[model samples]
Structures are given as structure tokens and as C-alpha cells.
Target chain A: MLNRVLHRRTSALVCSALTAALTGCGGGVDVIGYDVTIQQTSQCTVTGAAARNCEDPAVLGQTSLAARWFLETADDGVSVTVTTHEGRTIPGLLFDNNTNVINTEGCAGEGGRCVFVRRRYQTSDVNTGCSTFGELIFVGHFPPDAPQRLVGRFSDVAGNTEECGTPTINEVVFSVNGAKVEQPAQSLEGARP
Target chain B: MNRPLPMSPVLVGLAIGFAGCAGDGIDFFEVVRSRVDECAIRSNGEFCVEPEQFDPPTVEVWAVETRAEVALLYVDEEVWVLDPLPGDADPATVERTATKTSVVIDGLTGCRTDAVREVGFLSVVTRSAFGTTGTLDGSLSVRSVLTGPESCGSTPVGERTVDVVSGTVSGP
Candidate 1:
């Protein structure tokens, strides 16, 4: 009876040890997921200007315009924020980067500024030809609570050129990619006591 | 898959290691416990080492300087747009659209060298205008010198003005 009892106990302990390992090897918990998009629309009134194949090198003009950005995450532990940038000396495209029309007096300057907030990171792995165009930022967080998300508006510009004057109107489009959140399927193996 | 087994490969091996040694009066259960401790130390509660899952690193914010230029010339009614080049060590060539003209700079470069900027931008600003009467007078000029006193190389990094009609170029 003593030997039988001892054998039973050893077998149980062996099983427990193996089970613990299988669980660990399955896969660690997911940490973060990211999605982002950018869009712009421009319209200009051409006086004598006629467009050619307009492939490139050719100059084009636009009047008023709007631009926006959308950034998001799947895990609430992850946070997101955005900041704008413009050229102070050269020229930037954060919208009206070179034009000043708030007071109608117009901006008489040649330079500008830009900034980004928090620890930034790109959450998605999507290949955008313009990777440096925008940036991403994020680390990890806890509790495994709710999902996370963020949406932001960028800028607007009205033609400020004294020569041709700003364009009449234009349409712009931007995208904020999704986190492609995965819902882990319930496995009956773990449910088995 | 991990259900307890009355006789498993591990159990058989353990039993065989010291099978007949029980005749020497060694406690079988105690020997089994000792063997298990050795195996546990080697495997860390499992039968193998698990690989770690990893993701990309995050970055903190810092001051970023930017510059841009736009020229709406009256001569041929052409527009030129240009913006500041990103300052990174591992450089890359990029094409940025100004207004109507797409400015692709083959070498828009900059770096922190000897406490100064060793960088420049090159691009075909405006397309050649075809007008018999227009003069090469109207040009695009935008400048915000973010470099030290000795800037723009020997050429000077100031107003990046391009002769929009002449198809000639200048930069910061």
C-alpha cells in the first residue's frame, strides 16, 4: 500500500511540471498594436496657367486646403498624441506653412517651427513609401483592461500669395490605420482541469 | 496532453536508474524526489527554455528645426515649393512637392559636425517655361539660417532662391 501511494504521488507531480512548461511555451501575451494615416486636399484658380502631362518638374498651384491625421492603438496600455511642424526659413507642408492669414494683415516672415509629444512610436508595420513623412511612438502598459485609440485634426490653409491669390476651394483625405487587433481563440486544452 | 501517467518515459527512466538499488536499502521515493529536483533546476519549471517576444523601441521628444520656401512667379505664372530637410545620420534621397512643382532633392543632407552644420539641398525647382517674351528675373526666395556663422558651405546656407523661368537653381 505504501509503494502504491508513493508511485501515484510521483506520477502526479511529473504531470504538473510538464503542464507548466507547455503553458509557458505556447506564447507570451501580446503587448501593443498600431495604425496611422495622412491625407490632404488642395484647390487653386489658374489664371493663364495650363497644365501639361504635369508628370513632374512642372509647377502647379492651389488656393485653400485642409490636412488631417489619424493614429490609434489596440491596447489601452498604449497612449498616442500628435504635434505639427512647419518651415521657418525654407517651406513646410503642415498647411499654410509659409502663409499667414489669421489677421488678413498677412505674415511677413521667412521661417517656422514644429514639434511632437510624448514617447512616440509607429504601431503598424505597413510599408508607407513616406515612412519618414510621419512618426510613431509607444511602449507597453498593464492590467490588460480595455482597447485604446486616438484621432487628431492637422491644419488648414487659404491662398496667401499676393500674386495669384489663394485658390477658391479643394478636398483632402487622410487615413488612420487600424491596430488589426487579434481576438485570441479560446482553447479547450486550457479549459481541461 | 499533460495528464498524469502511471508509467511514462520519464518515470520508466527514473525507475530503471536505481531499480535494483532498492536492495541496498535506499528509499525509492526519496531518490525520485532528489532526481526531480535536479531536473527542475535544469528546466526552470519546464522541459525547455522559452523564447522571448519582442517589439520596437519608443523614443522621447526633442527640439526639431524646419525651413520651407514657396515662389509664385509673375513672369510665367509658375509656383515652386520647398521645405526643410530632415537631419538624420543614415541619409536618404527624397522628393517633396512644393506647390505645383515636385522638388526631388538627390542630396538633402545635414549632420552635427564640429558643432556646426555640414549639409545642403539639391533639386530641380521649376520646369522650363516656354514663353518668347518672359525674362529670367522672377525667382523664388525663402531662407531661415539654422546653421552656425560658417554656413551654406562656401556657397552660404541662406535664402534658397531658384530662377523659376531660367531653370537655374539655388538652395540653403
Candidate 2:
């Protein structure tokens, strides 16, 4: 009977709708993940520097050392959650190379460039404290004749009297540059001397 | 011959089983969905309102200008580690740690203002070290109450939605 046939089809539709709802609620999807580890080395330039704490007023005006970083970005990158040694989760941004660096101070100074890039949002556990730390990810094609190193200086914008150095990153692997290239001892952290 | 009526006990037991599964178990799902819905609502308030409460947080970032003596300038920042206070945990337990060690500025300062914008989860360059003349890179977490340019008034907005975002800063 037509009623019997219609009943069978209706049952099938109900089952299909339930499956779709569950899947839409963060189920049955393959998501990619990754992790990053940062290590500090002795290559830092500043010496005898006062520690800067936000909670303290006396040391309020000072330039803390720029934390050096090296990052990797991938679309098919494996999905692995990241946590600190202290059992805390770390939030990170996708590495993008195509960014613009602009100078904030007048052109009279040499080191006033700000790099801008779009964000690539991944995932995190909402219940946990896991979140993202927005840092620029580099991904783009450099001109064949583009210079390898960009020049700049670091100064104490605060009244504190201290000599700081440049920021550099070493051991860079251009993963997206068509050819897999590796540069040993790439320094992107320290101030240029 | 005609079939007799189904047994009374059999029919009653079947009805009870159907009612139990349909009524009680379904509520568990409803509870979870409601929790998520509440979070989504909170995220909306965080995005739409300015200088959202440091409590019941959704997403926020900070830019700290640590103006020290002329010779030694520095910047340090802190941000909420967890989303705004949900029902189960104590709000005071949400502690924030800097992205890196060695630098100072771990805690909130006394000169905090309430003026804030709905930045969601974005990190603004709170401070740039001196060597960044050519290109400087930095990162920090912000406290909602400390770093803002304005102050939140009494009877602040309630029941807002919040979002978690990952961001980056590069170039000069």
C-alpha cells in the first residue's frame, strides 16, 4: 500500500536527520593539529637588565627582551594539542609569511615597521583554559633578489638606561617556497650589533 | 476463533519503558545544549559591548605601554587564561601566565582603567623592545581590568556571549 511505502521512507528520513544533527554538533570530523617548542639560548644581547613586571610601578618603564620564535604552518599539518611543561595549554596562531611591516615612529628612525597578517583559527578545548596567542605567521613568496636580512635597532622607549639588541630566528626551513631549503644558524631574535 | 486481549502487565511495562527513555534521558541532552547556548550568548555580549567584565569573559587582548625612566623602556602584559567564570569554578582561580618567561609584568597594576573595546581574542602588541628598530616582534596577554583606557561603570551589562580567538603580530 502507498501508506506502507510512505512509512518506510519517513522512517529512513528520520534516521538521516538524527545522524546529520549529531555530526553538525562537533562530531565525525577529521581536524588537523600541531605543536611548537621554544628554547632560549645565550645569543641574547642585553646584559645586566632590570626585570619588567606589570604589577610593579618602579620597573614599569623598560624594554623586556623580545622572546625569539620559530614557527611552522601546514594545511594538512597533523593535529596535536599543545601544552606547556607546567601542565598549562598554549594558544598559537597559524604561521603566515605574507605580512607587512610598517614604522610607528616617524621616518627619522630606522626601526618602525609593523607586520600585519590575517589570522587562521584552528580549535581549542572551551572547557579548558586552552586559547590562542596571536603571533605573526610568515607564508609568502619573496622576490628572487630580495635581501635575506631586514635591518633594525632596539632602544629603551622607557626612561631606563639599557642597551638592547636585535631580534632573530635561526635554522629556518622555507616549507612553502617550492624547494625545500634549510638555513643553518638563522638568527632572527637578537638586536643587530 | 479470535485472539484474546494482550496481557495487562505486558502492556503496562512496555509503556513505562518507553516513557522512561523518552522523558528522562532526553533531558541530559537538553542540559548540555542549554549550556552551550548560554556560552554562545555570553560570546555575543563580549563582542558587542565595550570593556566587558573581566569576569564571565569571552575574548580580550591588551596593549601595555610601560613607560619607565627614559633609558629603560619595557612592556609586559597578561590576559585571562580561561573563558569567563562559568557556574562550577571560582573566578579567582583563573590565572594568566605570560607567553614567555624572563620578562616581568606578571600581575595586574593599580592604575587599571575600565575603558575597553570588544576585541574578542586578539593580542595587541602591548610593548616593543628597543632592538626592534628594523623589525621587532613581541607578544603578551592582557588583563581586562588593568590595561584598558576607560573604566566600566556600575551595573555593567550582563549575560553576554564571548568568543575565543588565536592571533599573531609581526614586522616592525
Per-model TM-score (chain A alone): 0.20, 0.22
For each prediction in turn, the share of the native Cα contacts (below 8 Å between chains A and B) that it retains comes to 0.02, 0.04
Best by DockQ: 2
Which model scores highest in lDDT?
A: 2
Q: Which CAPRI quality tier does the interface of model 2 achieve?
A: incorrect
Off by over 4 Å in 1: A1-24, A31-193, B1-172
Candidate 1's displacement at residue A141, Å, is 11
Residue lDDT tens for model 1, A1-193:
9966766776655554454344332112221222323232222333233332221222111111121122221123223333211211111112121334221111222223111123212233255322212222211111112224322222332221223243222122222222322321111112210
By TM-score, how accurate is candidate 1?
0.16
Q: Write the per-residue lDDT of candidate 2 for residues A1-193, one digit (tens) a residue.
A: 9965555455544444453444332122222111222222112122234332222223323212222222222233322222221222323332223233332322122322221223333334466534432222332222334323221222111121222132122111111112221321112122121
Scored by TM-score, the top model is 2
